[model samples]
Target: MRRLAFAILGLFLAAQGQAQSIVPAPPQVAAEAFILVDAATGFVIASEKPDAALPPASLTKLMTSYVLANEIAEGRLSRDEQVVVSENSWSQNPVFNGSSLMWIEPGKDVTIGELERGIVIASGNDATVAVAEHIAGSEEAFAELMNQHAERLGLSNSHFMNSHGLPDPNHYTTARDLAKLSAAIIREFPEHYARYKELDYTYNDIKQYNRNKLLREDPSVDGLKTGYTSEAGYGLVASAKRGDMRLISVVLGTSSPTARKNETRSLLNYGFRFYETARLLDAGEELEKPRVWKGQVDYAPVGVLDEIVLTLPRGKRQQVEQRVALVDDIEAPLAVGDSVGTLTLLLDGELLYQGPVVALEAVAPGGFFARLWDIILMWLASLFGG
Candidate 1:
């Protein structure tokens, strides 16, 4: 009996030691739906019912910002362009509407830049409506444009009923879709994303500060948007970059402001703690030397079009591997950016992302005489054994 008691005690101690060495607990979040994604690779780090559709509230402004960025990029609108505030924007706001506002009187002129500041820093519903009207000529038309852009971005779980994320039952988006949208904005528009980090903006002398508490909590937290309503609850789409790793986290339908902040912070912490980013291929890294039939060079260098970076869990770096393949015998004429081959990333034997390798420079077929000689050689070889 004494020996058995001692053995049991030893077994219990070993069990405890093993438990302590296991993976740490995941961070806790209070939101009803949430997702954390690595911005570089689109790899989902953590998600909780990320696909469930819920009210987006003012988070709809992310789509608004995306549209504005594209317009600015295309030269259709300028930051200095003036927009007139209509009765639609001012009449709905009183001291009681709980809406953020610049308190513009009807016919007051506001610049596109100020409108962007109002939407981003103040979460102004009126600002959203005004910007939408200015951009598309009507809020309804702007909503259509928003949905079209969402479709182009492959936001499958999203639908837009209004420019402002009001509590319309039809206006809904999934946490996963929101994260994708946020990532697209950050990846596609670096210059425009800078607006999200501004702590305060003065419109008509009313200084409105950004409500995203995470930006104040962590300097690395730069963007993107926040939302709240009785029906939609509190939601936030937040992003931060620490070193080479950038992450986008979305929390939807939280009970309170504190819960939204806490959940977003926890999700970001969890993502940063357990994951690290690795660059598998540097930009312009040559992958192959495909034979060129003609032109100035005998071989054309095949290289990656862009750097391939991935975010992986800690201690799993050794598991990341890549395979490069090139097209069979190249036939001369090739232009820069022409797809030549592919570099596939694999983790634990599962394909992650396949990056296409492109031709570095143009290669034209050789002189007519050289081409004729090659054709004759090929024909003769096919015609006779000798």
Candidate 2:
């Protein structure tokens, strides 16, 4: 009778835990496609049609910026240098209304720095075209460069046909791909990413405010870009960092600029409220020191090369469990960064992460006598289950 009562109590407690741990459904988002992701963990907090191909509009400038950042990073371009604005990239080269010009008239020299500000803060089509022409000799070639980068970044659902994100039937990207791109920009080139936060830029005596309204409203919304076109509707790829936890949101094909802003806020709010990203282990954090057979060192330290972070329901971080799957007979000579084992983290027995454990330092082979002794010890351990 006591055993029956205990079993029932245990089941009841488990059921209660499950009920308490349940995460609420992600908030409903009204857009053609949207995604919210934890920047550090690359975990999707909530998403709908993230991979659906859709027009990205001026958000293409992010890629244009990314390519330019890559160029500067690789020493092909410098910020201080200047490029001449061609007739094709003059102020009169207006297609879309508000973003038509940065006053970059024909045959004038503009520094790379000003052009970047013009592109990001002013959303100038002329500045983007000038950059495209200066870097790749033409927009067509620059687009090829963009596509190459897209492929390298594993943006499977993205394709770029122009440097400026003016509406073209073939120029399209996905919410998931844009999220990845934004994260990459923030992670890889922080210096350039910082430019996205500036409120306004002045070129040729005309100043315009950044169209990303969220930056002004939310203290956390530091950067990213906004886009609009007849086909793409209004799109915003916005990122905000409340603390160490940064979130990237993508809302595409909304009815108006106001809709995109509110929808993005909804996604960000849902993510920050319900989920928290935790860094479980730092790079080279030794999780185990396993016995090394036939090596100079009796024990070899193993750990991850990169930090491991995960996004889980808020307040549930303490419930995670860690496990190691390493070889029993770790014969050496082991080199630094050699694969030693696998480390896994689980929540309620559900796998969250599984990655390789590498040797923290090299281990040379032992002297002949030491090796013989180790072999004998290994043999005895196998026989006696030591």
Candidate 3:
């Protein structure tokens, strides 16, 4: 009876391990571009042709949100600031053209908050124009600001021609850049992002629903925007959080809204279903001590630059291990935060996260006598060419 119980326990453990290895199924969509990313760690969970540059359509609003949120955070702009609609914004540029309202007459008043809601909830090209004109004095100037912010955000595959994300030869972004931009908005502007999740917002006595259908489909999805144009096709940038794990999925150039939502949902679901976040090392946890030469202390304690965390699947922890590599005998006079080495977490021989190991405490060369002796020895060795 004891032997049989032990055998059953072993089988149960083995079955649990097998279950943990199961990964979420791949998304089914006809999108020309797609990307899935773990929002917390900025890890790329999956991607298919993520770098292909395409017209972003209304997805360009993500950049607008980034700029607006930054301005608000810095107190440069207030949400209640009233903006007067300009004729140029109403006129619309012929070169970069898309749907808009002839009814948004010039000389109308709208608050900054309304302008944001107009664009996000209504996908109003006119609202984008109004906000751009109010903020940067003109859409041309605003486009320059958008490109600058893109550069600052390290969006290598993005360029902005207009604020409204109308089809312009120059207005382009890739799936990866869009995902990065979306993640930045959520991380840097949590307060501003709250508006994106609003299912319906009323402006000028007109009720408008958010174009992002996933918000209605999945309660977990809270913030994001959707975009489309004749040339750009249907696109959606959606973000969702389940527990501490959040993911951003971008699907661009899909055939239709239903397809975009389905693909985005699949990508996000795969991320949540398969990946499990594990905290390996807490902040200030000493990972190792490396030998030091000619220092007051014989060795220096090295620790994670920040808390070490990873998003992985269950049962994979058994295959995970950290390898520490430190500089061979760090010289004296090392300062805190100095890079000493690196701690690499590996799973199945694949590198997951490589973090810098830094000096936790400063180590100066010993007494004056010790320093002088070291200098003399170095000089003698140089003179003798030894």
Top candidate by TM-score: 2
Per-residue lDDT over 1-386 for candidate 2, one digit per residue giving the tens place of the 0 to 100 score:
00110111012234353645668898888899999999998999999999999999889999999999999999999999899888788877646455545788776779998999988888888889899999999989999999999999999999999987887889999999999999999999999999999999887889899999999999999889998878889999999999779999999999998999999999999899889988888888887787888998889788888888899888677677777778667888999889877777877769898888889989999999999998899899879987
Worst 10 residues of 2 by lDDT: 1-10
Any idea what lDDT model 3 has? 0.80
Give lDDT tens digits, candidate 3, residues 1-386. Answer: 00110111012233343545767557666799999988878788889999999999989988987887888899989989988887666635454354743225566777888777777777777877887888899889999999999999899999999988877898899999998898899888888889999988776666777888888889999979899898999999999989888899999999998999888888888888878676777887787676665678768887875787788885475556667777644678889898877777776668887778889889988787776776676578568863
Q: What is the TM-score of each candidate against the true structure?
A: 0.80, 0.92, 0.84
> Which residue pairs in model 1 clash with each other?
294-366, 295-365, 295-366
Candidate 1 runs further than 4 Å off: 1-25, 91-96, 288-300, 325-342, 355-386
Give residue 186's error in model 3 in angstroms: 0.7
Model 1 has how many clashing residue pairs? 3
- Evaluated against the true structure, the overall lDDT of model 2 is 0.87
Q: Candidate 2: deviation at residue 84, Å?
A: 1.2
At residue 158, give the lDDT of candidate 3: 95
Instruction: List the candidate 2 regions with Cα displacement exceeding 4 Å.
Output: 1-19, 94-99
Candidate with more favorable, higher lDDT: 2 or 3: 2
